[model samples]
Target: MRIARWTVTDLIHDGFVIDDRVVEFPDGLTVADVLARGLSATGELYERVRDAAATPLADIRLLAPLVPAAVRDFVAFEEHVEGVSAGVEGKSDVAPEWYEAPTFYFTNPHTILGPDEPVSPPVTERLDFELELAAVIGAAPGVGQANLTAGDAASVIFGYTIMNDWSARDLQGREMKVRLGPAKGKDFGMSLGPWIVTADELAPYLDADGFLAVRAEVYVNDELVGEDLVSNMGWPFPELVAYASRNSCVVPGDVLGSGTVGNGGCLGELWGRNGSLTPPPLQTGDIVRMVVEGVGELVGAVGAHVAAPQLPRARTRTRARRR
Candidate 1:
């Protein structure tokens, strides 16, 4: 099922998509409510939704499928690390530790945007977009599912959605030199949705290694710039989820991103490979569109840059005598 949160006539609603129509869930119920009920009850819930009223998909405004409780984005693509490292940090080889485990960074949950929304980036000259797939967590069936094994982590994933980890490359490169943050460089904006495709619906595309073997593509101003197969990830979704639960817990609405794909997933990789900015950075009014075969398309626009106010610089420290 394709589940969505949308608004019509200024009223928000939760519904599931059927063909070109949206079947509204009964009042006061939501996708979270359905997911909390567990996967076994999906059939009955679908029947109930089908029996209710539906609206034409064109008549409503789509929203980010859910408000994430937390967002953790992982670097699961080796090619992405290689290319981005060479491009942004001038490194040719990936760090050895990257191969030992799946790695991720937390991003802002409050700035999530949905399809067709405009992303107003901070003052930046090198704006870029990361083409990724995001897994949304649902209620776990048993207690103490923490520190899960890779095989068991699959149970907590409710569905998948398209993700755009919007970035300011220039700002990012400057900060990471201190080896601390991709912080403000990222976290300004992220995009998810159109809707969520329940995990069961994507079963046909799962590869032998458990990776989603779907094609992912990215376009800027309607021109196809990058494309890759989702299965190219160095680690699969379950492992990413499992690693996330290592000594920690992930709850329903927590999101895990599949990092950026390779072979054109982002302009930074292209720049790194070619040694020149052939396809210039994103500009105001430029449109970005991403498509993942089973998950659907997510489209967003770049709005005007919001200028930052002058920041006070830190003063140099003076030597002090031991007390």
Candidate 2:
């Protein structure tokens, strides 16, 4: 089943997106409400609204599925890591440690936006989008395992959604060099939705290798820029989620994004394809659309460039290298 949150008029509602129609929960039910009881509880809710009167898909405006409890985006793709490392640092190899564990970072849940929303990038140029699939964490209260092993990932995963992790390449490149952050560069906004498809709905497509054999694609201004298969990632969602929940907890509404796919999933990778000549980065009015076969699509236009302000520093230049 596909779950969605959208606005019909001045009122916002949570509902099931079934075949070009939205079957809203009779009351003020929300994604959060259903998540609290865990996705295992969705069966009954699905039954409740399965046959209800629905609004036409074109009549309502979709919103971000929910205000997540937290968002953790994991870099599970080796090719993406290697490509980015080489593109930015001129380094061509993945660190030995990177292969041992899945690494991720927390992103701003507050900046979340929905499909068709406008993204105001931090700068007018060098903006990019990452095509990814985000798995929403189910309620952690009881799943028969407290430690949460990779083997138990299926029990805790509720569903998936397509994500466009927007980036200001210049800002990211600068800050990341200091070994501090991708902050300010990545936190501007992230687009998620179309709707969330429950795990059970995707069971049929699970491959023999235990990976979801889904095709991922990114289009900018209706031109295809990137495409890849989700199975290319070395570490699967279960491993990433298990690692995340280790020594901690993952609650309902928590979202974890499968990092950018390989084979030119973003301009950073695409620009580095050839030496000097490259296509332009995202600018105002560029529409970035991401599609994950089972998860659906997310489309957002680059609205406008934000005017950058002065940086706080005691000096303008760093110390010179020794002779």
Q: Evaluate all candidate structures by whole-model CA lDDT and list the values in order.
A: 0.89, 0.83
Candidate 1 lDDT over residue span 1-323, tens digit each? 88899999888888789998998777578877866665657666788778577899999999999888899999999898888888876775699999999999999999999999999999999999999999988876631367888877888888999999999999998888899779889989999998989999998999998999999999998999999999999999989999999888888788899999999899999888877786899999999999999989999999999988888888887667774
Highest lDDT, which number?
1
User: Cα lDDT of model 1 overall?
Assistant: 0.89
Alpha-carbon runs more than 4 Å astray in model 1: 142-144, 319-323
Task: Give me the candidate number with maximum TM-score.
Answer: 1
Per-model TM-score on C-alpha atoms: 0.96, 0.93
Residue-wise lDDT of candidate 2 within 1-323, one digit each (tens)?
Answer: 89899987669889899898999865677888887777767778888878998889999999998788888988888878777776676765688988888889999999999989999887635788888988987764444344588877767888999888999888888888898878999999988898889988887777887788899999988988888999888787878888887778788898999988987787777666543326688888888888889788899999978787877786676677975
Minimal lDDT window, size 10, model 2: 138-147
